[model samples]
Target chain A: MTEKTLIDARGSFCPGPLMELIAQLKSAEVGDEFEVLSSDKGSANDIPEWVEKAGHELVESREDKGVWHITVKKKR
Target chain B: MRILIIGGGMGGTILANNLARRLSSEIKAGKVNLTMLSASEKHFYQPGLLYLAVGQMMPDELYREQVSLLEPGIAFHVDPVTEFHLDENQVKTQSDRTYDYDVLVIATGSRVNMEEIPGLAENAEMFYTEEGALKMLKSLREFEGGRVVVCVGVPHKCPMAPLEITFMMHDFFKERGILDKVELYYTYPIGRIHSLENVAKWATPEFDQLGIKYETFFNMKEVDGDNKILRSEEGAEVNYDLLVTIPAHKGMEVVESQGLGKDGWVPIDRLRLNMEGRDNVFAIGDTTNLPISKAGSTAHFEAEALGENIASMVKIGQPVRDYDGKVFCFIEAGKDRATYASFDYLNPPDPKPPTRAVHWFKVAYNQLYWASARGLL
Candidate 1:
């Protein structure tokens, strides 16, 4: 099982959540899984799209308590 | 008394609004008349255009009707100025209308000199016009991943625009699965990414993370369109598949022809906003040769001070207000993050300093503009 990291992007807008995720991804090891939580509706959809395009893997995504939780795996 | 304003840009419109509110009260008492002359009918939210160029914003999001922006007390003229008869205290428009003024404000603004570099206007794309933005978008959409060069010509408006474009290009290619195939290069005449030290500190890391190559002290001299190359003043040649260039910016021709401007810009006293050697005449915004950033924030600040100064002159024949050369700018660094920078003659005298808080403030400020423009604030 890979180690898990959590990103709290609640209350942030588009590009904000994405930028935070990118910064975290830079320090994470390959194969590590990170979870991103965002309140911006656009990011709930945009993050997975960015992950897929950037050669990363999207593990899971869900909405709970009005906040979105998305999990991504570092592939490269 | 009659007052005339020569431009309808940020400084002109703000002054017009302030003056209208003040003069309207006086006009009812038969005290004064106000007139505003603008070359264009559309009012552009110029800062928003950078977002538009990056596909984050649409064209309709950046403009308003010119007439609607002006208050009712001021007469609006939609004509370009042909000549400034300064000695006679009159201005002749392209339509041949002559207007005399008890006081004159020259806010004619700057113009893009695309002809300075050979083949650049024809080959490279620009972001100064709506058409140019559309063209650049189309080019980006059809691009198949190659070297993209973003160059800043000397003394251009919005210094961070080239960096913003670079960030967006990085995001664009990354989104298209072509990040590996594309390379982005930023070239400028300055030593760093931005003139403010606070901004450059934050931006240098972002550029490194995005793998965007940058060259400082590189002056763009010419574009060899046929060979797909850009030559700098230092004899270095850079090859590119797509080129985005910000051409040289110059002052309005009317100021040049009337000998009121130096090197294509009107020289105004930084403290008073008054034209050099001329009393009761002022210049503001990008039109004046002020030692300040040519951003909208500076213009707005100048307009506020200028309005009060003019009002003082009207009320007591004394000009009391002073301009502080304060400038605040928001640099968008893609991925929904931006950095903010605020500088004046007193603090961080250098142009490129990095501050992360300023970037967040910029994001907040955009929301503030939306609220303010709609009069919600």
Candidate 2:
């Protein structure tokens, strides 16, 4: 069984949410999944871009109630 | 392990607090010690000065007690550092105390030298400090109309402040019904309006639309207050009734006094952030000679990077990550609109058109910055 880590990165500005996601992904196991909730529109777009460039798997991306939900699975 | 962080400003404070959290167990077990020394008991939010100058915020909102922001398990002090004994891995403070550390982080920050230009300090309006911002507000209130020249110095903190202030001033005068009476002119030391290429491209059209005249390649040579004349190194002179300036900056006094780097900017490895030759000695924020924006986000990101690395070094004997030269800045485009530029070492930022939503976000960020300083946000 794999656990999904949820990070509440709302109210933080650009690069804050992305950084938190990266910090978690750095220590996460290869198959572990982590989701980040960010109110910053810039970081919502940035997290997936970073995930793609970093060779991670973007499992899901959605928006609800002005909050962005981005989930990525560790591939490395 | 003794971690001595000198200068309890944004970089040092964030790094210390972050380390305190990551190494909490080690701290409790007496395996690690975290100490910080700063010059002041108050931690100032520098970005507030811009809003203060524009009357969007007040002075009392910009300060918080430095020790109040720190987490427990980190030893904090207000004694300023006087000397750097890097060879002995120790530092001497003004109160005649010596601190030794296995790892040293130098976040001493930078300072503006307005005196470098003759008549500048005495005559021009500057908003880099609390007093400067208050004085500028008074000057703005007293002035009805004239040629207001906004000249910028190189390597200053907050790369967006020059343009932000210019745009905000336009709105300020407009709201005061003196928009047509004031002739706002801007000057930059570089060929472009901003050091960043993309920002210059974006701001040029905005300046043209706003009726803000500008001259590039204008390095401030001196200010003639008596004659109201401003001279640049390129020899083109600008005549103005009111002079607003951003003075050139240099690293902290101790950094220069100890022969750290040219003009007090200690050279560091871009990724590792270690002072040129020493692995244990690290430099960040405005003090490092990195060709990047000297903004708060730069320091924040660098501190987090250093914190993680230091913690990993204490636990795993090596760093797991590197700083990618990240910087994020919100550009206030006046009239209650703003946009942001976000980029890193390998990527350049593409700032979109200003939006009301982005502007409100910036306004909210002014309040949220407190949480950020506490390493909470």
Candidate 3:
């Protein structure tokens, strides 16, 4: 079974959203999809970079209504 | 459970607020008590002081009442701590109030000691404090132009400040139409322009492009104010018309006087953040002897880690998390473009090229920092 999780890390700064994503990814199964929503611009740029560094797949990233929605697929 | 946090700076405030939110039910149930002891009623956003020196930010824009930023669950006081009794789990304040805590967090932060350099304090302009920044602003405005030497010392609180100010001043001179009159010479104590290698790599070309002259391994030995010359420990010297400096920093006086850690920085478990032998006691941010940048972001992350751990200790049996040595800093490339450094214990920062969008974000973060202290961001 696979699960898609949405982490509303809005109103958090750098490493706040990233830490939350990593925490959630710990329990998430491989191939799980995680979407993080954040208002912080630092996290938006950072999340993609982190995802790439951690060898995860960055599926899609878009901004809407002053919030960024970044989707990632857990690879490990 | 009684938790006492000393120092109302970024780390202490964030930890207190985080605990307030996380342990609210316990606080309401009379199972938890959170108290904060601070040296000042005003929480000055220290980072804004950089812009303040350059006149990009004003003095009024940098402060908030310590009481206002806290959640209702916290008991706040303005009495500065005078002594730490780690054996008895107690602290004595300037007001003669003794506080006992089941858990204690010390975030007393660091201070600039310009006096550490002979003739430097009186001769050079600085931006480490409100008064100093204001003086620098006035000095910058009065100056027609000459060689402006930015001499930096080691272990300053903000890792990027020296570079940030140097780059920002370049634009300031350009805007004032004195770009031709001023020569910018930046000096760093280390072998590289920055303590962080990648940041040094990223800045070298930028410095070249902007014609910002720099000298590495230029540790300040003394300032020959009479001759208007700067001397370095490495046997180098330069003549300057204007001297700006970022002095070496030490952790607060109370920390050192109380035998907490050498030079006021408490030795702590890097991941656990506990005072080496005392688990009930913890240190964060600039107050710790951790070999990392003593910036607000370091404290903020440490606070979050402790917040979770402390709250969990109350709700469960043990701490739930560990601090992973994370720090994020935005480097203002110039007046309008910026880049950032984000890294952890296992990673080294590889700063990307400057972008206008990132600069706007750094601008936004200046205001957002308040919310961050409130543990909202």
Lowest lDDT 10-residue stretch of candidate 2 chain B = B189-198
**Ranking 1 against 3 by TM-score, winner:** 3
What is every candidate's C-alpha DockQ against the true complex, given to 2 decimals? 0.01, 0.02, 0.02
> What DockQ would you assign to candidate 3?
0.02
Candidate 1 residue A68 Cα shift, in angstroms, is 56
True contacts kept of each: 0.00, 0.00, 0.00
> For each candidate, what is the lDDT?
0.74, 0.85, 0.86
Q: Which portions of model 1 miss their true places by more than 4 Å?
A: A1-76, B349-377
Model 2: residue B12 alpha-carbon error in angstroms: 0.9
lDDT per residue for candidate 3 within B184-298, as digits (tens), equals 9999754558767689899999999989999875768899999999997557899999999988788899998988976687988888999989989999989987766778899
TM-score of each: 0.78, 0.83, 0.83
Chain B TM, per prediction: 0.92, 0.99, 0.99
In model 3 chain B, which range of ten residues has the least summed lDDT?
Answer: B188-197
Docking class of 3: incorrect
